[model samples]
Target: MRNYWVRIALGALVIFTVGMVARALINRGIGGVRGVVEGSGPLSIPLAFIPFRLGGDKLGTLERVTFERTAPQSVSSVRLEVKLSDSLLARGLEGCRLAANLDSKDGHRRLSESTFWCAPAGSDTALVEYGQAVFRPGEVSVPLYLPQDLIDELQDLNFDGDSTPISEAEIDSLEASTELSVDSAPVLRARMGDSLRAEGMRRADSAKGVPSRMADSTRSR
Candidate 1:
């Protein structure tokens, strides 16, 4: 009887241990999905994953959201591309402004922020103005400029105050919140999920068939 009781206790302990491990793994996965950079530098969060809100109401659905650093060595600029939902467009985007806020890992620090004026020219499709660049709602190439002080802060954080070029700086994690102006107040907000990884950047570059400068330099060597 004593041996049987011991076996039962051991079985229970094993089950409990396995359950705890599985829970931890599941939580880790959830956290990653919530906000973790991909292996590449670009952070593309699907619209379906983002929650949009306008005051007490849920804003309409968006099609896509993408944020990416333009160049391998450039850390002062990033591109933000978002596809406005039909409901949002129907509400009118003329004279609206799109803004983004970038926060540090702990969400306690504001790394950088930028805003672009949106002036739609049509209903189904429109050219929006961001700085001197004009682009359609879904297609994006213009880079959002970051402040110099913030750029310095980002570089120091990634490089540990070292002068090493940030060509491959591991940003690790960042939180991006996007907003759209309605009636002069931001009515739509979406927080992007996760960190941006260097590995993913390489994959993106390869997929675009655009060789990185690192590769070009290596070939020249």
Candidate 2:
């Protein structure tokens, strides 16, 4: 009886250890998602982890931002390019949104821009283009754009044009320093029907005991 109990305890310990290790691996694999936004100024906004779920039925996170030039020194139209990480694109993109950050009042911000859903990536890459009007002196508001959890990260963005725009040489140097590809591809957007269908399929698969592929698709080296 004593030997049998010892064997059972050992087996339980082994199972517990294996479970913890697998959980750790899953967490590390399902890492944060990111994207880069360029133009509107010399500097750019790099948004990440804007309220995404991990290790669940949810597959990915969506980030939408609008770049606006303030009045007195505004361009007719600013060329904005957003490059998404393969991880975010692989799990699938919900949409792109142009949000304005209006002058905040009543201790809250408001969104005046529109929202757009992007198409799923059928290949390794995709692109889209869009145009937005500039408002001088008045602010464009994008209140609920960023993931609420990661909203604090926006404080680091240098929207003020006081700083010199990145020089061509600097841009070239930075591009050379990184292996990441920066494309002028059209912005990626998915249709609302596609999004709903995808979500329904994911839910059905979940109920059928199928594991989510988000972590497998999003794991970055």
Candidate 3:
């Protein structure tokens, strides 16, 4: 009887280990963040597991997030809290820190964060944006960083000195499709529900390198 129990325990351990290995292998996508550089400062000396995606679009919104590593843990999904660096903010987030809270590959998307520059010099003003997705089964939020002035200038027809996007109509539709992650991670697309309609079309919060383009798109309004 004693030997039987021992064998059962070992079997369970083996199964668990195999599953964990599979998970890691599938999640290698974390490395897709080719241009970013991340370090485990808040995490334990050795990380049990950390997954985050990097890279940005035209505006540079931090295709990822940052979180603190709670020493270590077994295989599972969790939110790792972390801090943003001044360099990322100044350098324009082309490369920076990344943190995430999710299981293995094909895992659900959760919280994320990053930092970006506000202005050139004497400009300490920075903006941070956070988003969440309430899937049919669960809800998740991704961290984001964008320029305030830029968002306003491009998203709004009045501020929008360009013409690539909506302009004349009443903005009857203000939502996003799966292919459009206008202000979030590259892997995840956003579905902005219809609520942005205002008197004339409220200005939207533009990402860092976006508003300027919007203006450029136009004749300079």
Candidate 4:
């Protein structure tokens, strides 16, 4: 009886350990989801998440809108880019730009406002000729310049009462407005969508002939 009880206890311990490990792996995978913004309109400009390679083949994504301090108390200006689906070009949605309205954490004040212009790789201007020649079919990353003064102000707002110095801060709750032309009036306005991971997983499941939960529920109704 003693030997049997020992074996049962050992089996239970093994199962518990396996469950904990599996839960941790699942949470880690979920937390790795990248942030993305998808456009909505007749000329639907789906913002795709293309893996950016950095420092010799290391792959990553634009997970957040972060502001970094260059010195102890001074911040440097930084530029961020967002990738648009290549279908935009074929669908005659070229010369488009995204105007983002970043609000403060309290949602009472606007932190910074900037526009993302189609800046081709290795080019400074967002001219039609330059942008078309460089980014044709795959995707194009448009750049949004954030000034140093804006970063400094944000740091002051996002700071917590801690001993650790604030080196970086992330801006949340961005409202993106799509303009048909650079510096023109916005044609359509929309908020950023669900996580890139959720979108990718749905696509993968669809490709594998798995019916979506929504579709199944609809059929039952």
Model number with the top lDDT = 1
Return the candidate ranking by lDDT, descending: 1, 2, 4, 3
Question: Which portions of model 3 miss their true places by more than 4 Å?
Answer: 1-125, 130-138, 159-221
CA shift of 186, model 2, Å = 29
Q: Cα lDDT for residue 84, model 2?
A: 33
The stretch of ten residues in a row with the least summed lDDT in candidate 3 is 131-140
Off by over 4 Å in 4: 1-68, 81-83, 87-97, 104-139, 145-149, 152-221
Computed on alpha carbons, the lDDT of every model, listed in order, comes to 0.31, 0.28, 0.25, 0.28
Quote the lDDT for 157 in model 2. 36
Q: What digit string (tens of lDDT, one per residue) describes model 2 on residues 1-67? A: 2332222222212221112212222232323211111233422222232212211122232232233
CA RMSD of each candidate after superposition: 20.1, 23.7, 22.5, 22.0
Please, what are the lDDT tens digits per residue for candidate 4 over residues 1-221?
Answer: 23322222222122211122222223334342211101111111112232222211212222223223443222232333333333333122233332223334342333222323323444533222211112233343433432233444433422122224212121111112111111232322222122333444455556556556767878999
Kindly indicate the candidate among 2 and 4 with the higher TM-score: 4
Which window of ten consecutive residues has the lowest lDDT sum in model 4?
35-44
For model 2, what is the error of residue 167's alpha carbon versus the real structure, in angstroms, after optimal superposition? Answer: 33
Task: Report the C-alpha lDDT of model 1 over 1-221, residue by residue, as the tens digit.
Answer: 23322322222122211122222223334445322222235433333323222222223433333334343222323333333443223223323343323334332333222223232234212222222211234233343333344455333332122333212112111111222121233344442111112333444456566556667878999
Over all chains combined, what TM-score does candidate 2 have? 0.21
Alpha-carbon TM-score of each model against the true structure: 0.30, 0.21, 0.17, 0.25
